[model samples]
Target: MTLDCFCGGVRVTTVKKPEFLHACNCDLCRKSGARWGYFDPSEAAIDGQTSSYRRHDKPEPAVDVHFCPKCGSTTHFRLTERAASTFGDTMMGVNMALSDQADLVGVELRYPDGMAWSGEGAFGYTRESRILGPDG
Candidate 1:
């Protein structure tokens, strides 16, 4: 799959289908207006010089959000060494806003409560979402 930011400054390519598609209600995610798709670093590739925002809320396992330089659209994310160790070394998060909505028509979405994510707790999933298009 190939996707790009609004102004086309950032581009992403996924070699394999996403293992998980999430619609997180985290502060940052809510503001950015993007759904997420989880994949291995080797499975997806991002091409661009994007600006990144590192969440300072958590000390370890940094989750860096990367946005397009031109349109400032959140495109993807990169996990730091600590995060890689905490999760998987190769895990990456892709923002679905990079792709056309039609392309995501049939994909299922998982709702996660990232706003309350804690070190001692696991993410609380709220619900499942499905794309409802003309076909439906």
Candidate 2:
């Protein structure tokens, strides 16, 4: 599936469905309004140019959030250099909200407690997870 920015200036194509989607309340995810779907860099392809932002609040921010320069819509994010060195380039996040709602059927949506995450391990859920139905 391909997800495009609001202006269609940037596109992210995924070869397979995400294992799950995260509705996180982390400062960055919340403020950016991104519903994240994870993928390996090799599993997806990104096209077009984008501006990116990396949080300075944390001593070592993890991802560099990218957005379409033409429309300011969040597109996708990659691990920062520091983070990549530690975690490798195995995962990235694509903004699932950019895709057609119909494309998300049967996908699991999880509410992770990103705010409480210590940045070293798996996240706990803040709310129960749900599977998207056809109606979405």
Candidate 3:
């Protein structure tokens, strides 16, 4: 599967289906203004100019996040422990906002309630779709 950014500045091709898909309520995650989906890193075939940023509270040893250098659009992320696990090492968290084909992904949106979320996550879609239909 190929995930392309809405601006066409970033693209990620992966061979494995995402292990799980959910939205986060972390401050930075919300501020980034993206809907979230995660995948196994081994399944990802990444190419393009990207830079990684890390969080101070990452549970894993290292959480490398990839983003488009040009537009500063976050694309994906990888965790250190997940990278060494036999169960398809490496985990990638994708920014749903970057995807142009979000609806086709069949992503089951989630709203993490533990932390403070800026705007509604997948809930926004439900409201929007109700008002504008799937075309929205």
Candidate 4:
């Protein structure tokens, strides 16, 4: 599926639906208003110009969040150079909020407690997971 930013200045094309979408309640994710769909960098293709931000709150942030320079819409995220060196740049996350509700029907939505996460291992969920419906 292909998704575009508000101004269509940035686009992301995914080869397949994400296994699940993460509705995280972390400082960055909350402020950015992004519902993350994780994929291998190879599973998705990104087009167009973007500006990116790496978190300053952490001494070594894991990913660099990218947004459309024209519309200021959060687009996708890639591993930071430091993070890539340690973890290998195998994963990327697209902001699924860019997708139409109908396009994500039946997609599982998971709520991860990012705020409480230690950034080391699995995190507890703030709530149970649910599948998106036509109305969502």
The CA lDDT of each predicted structure is 0.79, 0.93, 0.60, 0.95
Query: What is the Cα root-mean-square deviation between model 1 and the actual structure?
Result: 2.3
Question: Which lDDT value does model 1 have at 12?
Answer: 94
Candidate 2 TM-score over all chains jointly: 0.96
Residue 63 accuracy (lDDT) in model 4: 94
- TM-score versus the correct structure, for each prediction: 0.85, 0.96, 0.65, 0.98
Q: Rank the candidates by lDDT, best first.
A: 4, 2, 1, 3
> Which stretches of candidate 3 lie above 4 Å from their native place?
16-20, 57-62, 81-88, 102-105, 114-136
Q: Per model, state how many residue pairs clash.
A: 0, 0, 3, 0
lDDT of 1 by residue, 1-136 (tens): 8998988888999985565578888888889987888887888888888998887766664678899878899998888767777766777789876676667666777788887777556788767666535342
Per-residue lDDT tens digits of candidate 4, residues 1-136?
9999999999999998888999999999999999999999999999999999999998879999999999999999999888889999899999999998999999999999999998999989999999999987
Weakest lDDT window of 10 consecutive positions for candidate 3 = 124-133
The parts of candidate 4 lying over 4 Å away from their true place are none
Candidate 1 regions exceeding 4 Å error are: 131-136
lDDT of 3 by residue, 1-136 (tens): 7777656677887664443445555666676766656666566666777888776664543457678888778788776555456335545677756545544354445556525433334333212111112442
* lDDT by residue for model 2 (1-136), tens: 9999998899999998888999999999999999999999998899999999999988999999999989999989999988899889889999999988899999999999999999887999998999998776
Clashing pairs in 2: none
